[model samples]
Target: MRFRFVERNRGFFGRVAVAVAGAVKASVAAIGVLALSASPAAAGPTPDYGIDFAIIGDPGNRHVNFDEGRRFYPPYAHEGFTVGTVNYKYRMSRTEITVGQWLEFVNAYRPYYDGPTNAGQFTSDWIVYDNSLGRYRAISGSENFAANMGWRFAARFCNWLHNGKVMEQWAFENGAYDTSTFGRDDNGNYTDQPVRHADAKFWIPNLDEWIKAMHWDPNKNDGEGGYWRYPTSSDEAPISGPPGTGETNAGTWNFYDVGSYPHTTSPWGLLDGSGGRSEHLETLASSSGVRLTNGSDWGGLVSFDEIDRTASELPISSRSGLRLGSIVPSPPAFVALLVVGAVVAQARRR
Candidate 1:
């Protein structure tokens, strides 16, 4: 993937201004513009699955397992306390998987449907099985809504994408995760694979990956490293309301359209990390029988969506949403992009 460097102002006001009214459209356009430039692109081209991803490039950054010494009412979980600290680079979807994206996967996989990972269950009632047509369709006006699916189904979606999105049964079984590992052992404990294969190109984000994307800022502390209190890139609590009325369309009674709050974004330019829907992580919760989920749904309270709050649910539960994680493109493309980025930084200083 060839790319040209698009120098962006990393200042606080600069980020806010870029994320105004037409944010989603502008972000997509910016991705395209990066690809058209002569140097290596910072992010890869939008994949065939149509999920645009943001590049998380800070490697070997230290982790912040605690609450930065803030002794809030509820203490931090020091047991699984690690946050950020990824030694390698990766990319995460800018927003949760939408109903339309799920529908396309369902149609392709239906050519050879398996008993499990039902497409109908992937997005609540927004995606329904059309008996007459022998396929699934997205509800009117729900094509862009974030999808909530079972963790297993989300894993299979990653498998399908990793295998080039083929329509065969094998394509959905094993690529990033092994479907055969989706059973419990004789001890009655869940026996799913603990992590994605080393060669995995796409898979569910683990705790580290998800937290880093939502919180880590490479430019913090004179480029040493830092994290935000919330995914909206602000330490302040977001006001609850409809799009264009608040920093985030979260902490409300209903779900807002995905990416509706164009003004909210993480340091890496990811959207809806706090509101929208709580997303599943491959990391297991501290509690047994549930997997960890980061962020909170639209209906959650202000404290529920804070960076310190981590939610979890049963793996079979379809309550959590999906965010696809992927490795950065080939080394040559990434290296070229970085070189160009450095040159641009130097030019800006002059």
Candidate 2:
């Protein structure tokens, strides 16, 4: 696969690319980081799935699992969380939540939580859900969880809700659904608002939803199928020498930028899921012993080939950061146009 980054940002992207290669050389893999869960969610739990519907083959194969010695995995980790009101059936919006998407959340609650993860889940003091203020604010969170990393926050919200917990923390704090609404006896005075799903974008992924957004399909069938890390998965740290190394299939590849290999992208054209960070769907494990605390971040997404084989055996925050997971109805037209322009511009220069 080939990717042509814009010229103006080529230098910057180059630095990022180099750093990614360096990190992969050191053998750090961006698995998945999600907040920990403590209970077994309902038997048939469904998370708040949000994203452009991609026709996934088997998304759960790469999802988290538990080792009670019974080997249990959710239908799809995305299926663990849920959104929309009880009466509303949600249809995921295509595309990931972009940087702009989370900013809305950050800005909306500025008066409440003013912390500085950049996504606005905290208050100015950088604390999370500070209770003393009797309002929404950030408390001093050191561990990575929902909110800051973007997509992981989306996944975390779903994980929390799938556990049948207080999924309405944000809305309740903002007074969107107050006591009057809960105890409403006057049907005539109900506000002209439609019942929103919890956090509006949280839900589980059906097989189709997962595959399309991530754009992954593995030929290896390692467990369910080979765990393709992300788009730049194959382009990561170039294999320095002979075979038997984990970075390359033949172990003779070389360093390349994330998503630089566009050919590896899914047929639907999603990039970097195999060689980059593993986007969070939900929890990796409900066991306190094995929980992921952060979402897949940019650093994680660039070097898919560098990961070790124990992928099925590690904890999450032990993973990486998050992305702007979206629920957009379709891949944005602009993305394709942008890629075409990048490719053309690079070729012309040559």
Candidate 3:
């Protein structure tokens, strides 16, 4: 009888151990599922900066003719007669880089120009951070408004994004910017142009890229396609709103919230290509080696045909901003699934 009792006790304990182990394995598998669901691969190419990009397919044979200039004025000798013929496909940001996005870059990298890093500098003049609010707010009551910054500053922002915002080094191997190309003076001021890497993941769009994305309509001109006279994707200037309203109007021509003008869109569905803040382009002026800026800003004369090639040397007060372009690969969904499977198998083995 004693032997039988001992055998029964052992069987009960063994069953309990099995049940506990099974529960543990089940718990681990559940955790793994949760991790996979929250993984970055599952989320895809969602940047922390809240910037969205639109894919631009190659629109073959689009060009602008400034020689036979349109209604406003005759073409200047400096303005090029033709611009286009970009064959490579690329992606462009859907909207200008907003003040909110700039704040994110500032907060993360804390660049040299940030007021706190240097004395006698003013933050409010550029961006205002409200500690009490616990949120970075735009000073001009337009958080969605495009950021106005210098060309060098904009270049650094692109570098920050390229390095995943972790590297302290300004230029890293396989990085976006080639620091060697950056010219510096005796005072350590950057005097020369910063050259972008040939294989950069992100960069400011060149003149051809910008024009093709903004003005080219694939179905226009009997399907042969041609560049629009204006960045509104129309030959006509956009109708503006009343004064003091800060809306799109003939008089104000002020920058509108991105995508507010539903009628204005590129062939690839990019908004705010025109009638927003002037965007810095990667193209350099041959005469001055200054970077080009395209499109007219709000509160300025609307001339889609007008190109500010000397925008790089423009004062800080100029309402110039940047838009990013890239061809980064999308996250692989299959890889995420495989990771989940592997995790489950390991848990079962244990």
**TM-scores, in order shown?**
0.76, 0.33, 0.66
**Runs in model 3 lying further than 4 Å from the true structure:** 1-49, 59-62, 65-82, 111-126, 129-137, 171-174, 184-195, 242-255, 304-318, 328-350
Clashes of 1: 2
Model 2 regions more than 4 Å off: 1-53, 57-96, 114-201, 204-264, 274-278, 293-350
Candidate 1: stretches off by over 4 Å: 1-48, 65-80, 111-120, 286-289, 331-350
User: What tens digits encode model 3's per-residue C-alpha lDDT throughout 292-343?
Assistant: 7777666666654333222444312235788887753444556545554565
lDDT by residue (43-119, candidate 1, tens digit) is: 34436467788878767777864554242223544444456677777788999998888888777766665555344
Question: In lDDT terms, how accurate is model 3?
Answer: 0.58
Shift of residue 116 alpha carbon in model 1, Å: 8.5
lDDT score, residue 63, model 1? 82
| lDDT per residue (tens digit) for residues 15-104 in model 2 | 454443444333222211111111111112333333233323332334322321011234433445321111112233223333333333
Query: Where is the poorest 10-residue window by lDDT in model 2?
Result: 31-40
Best prediction by lDDT: 1
Residue pairs in steric clash, candidate 1?
Answer: 3-39, 3-41
For model 3, the run of ten residues with the poorest summed lDDT: 117-126
| Candidate number of the best TM-score | 1
Kindly provide the TM-score of model 1 when superposed on the true structure, using C-alpha atoms. Answer: 0.76
Candidate lDDT (C-alpha), each: 0.72, 0.32, 0.58
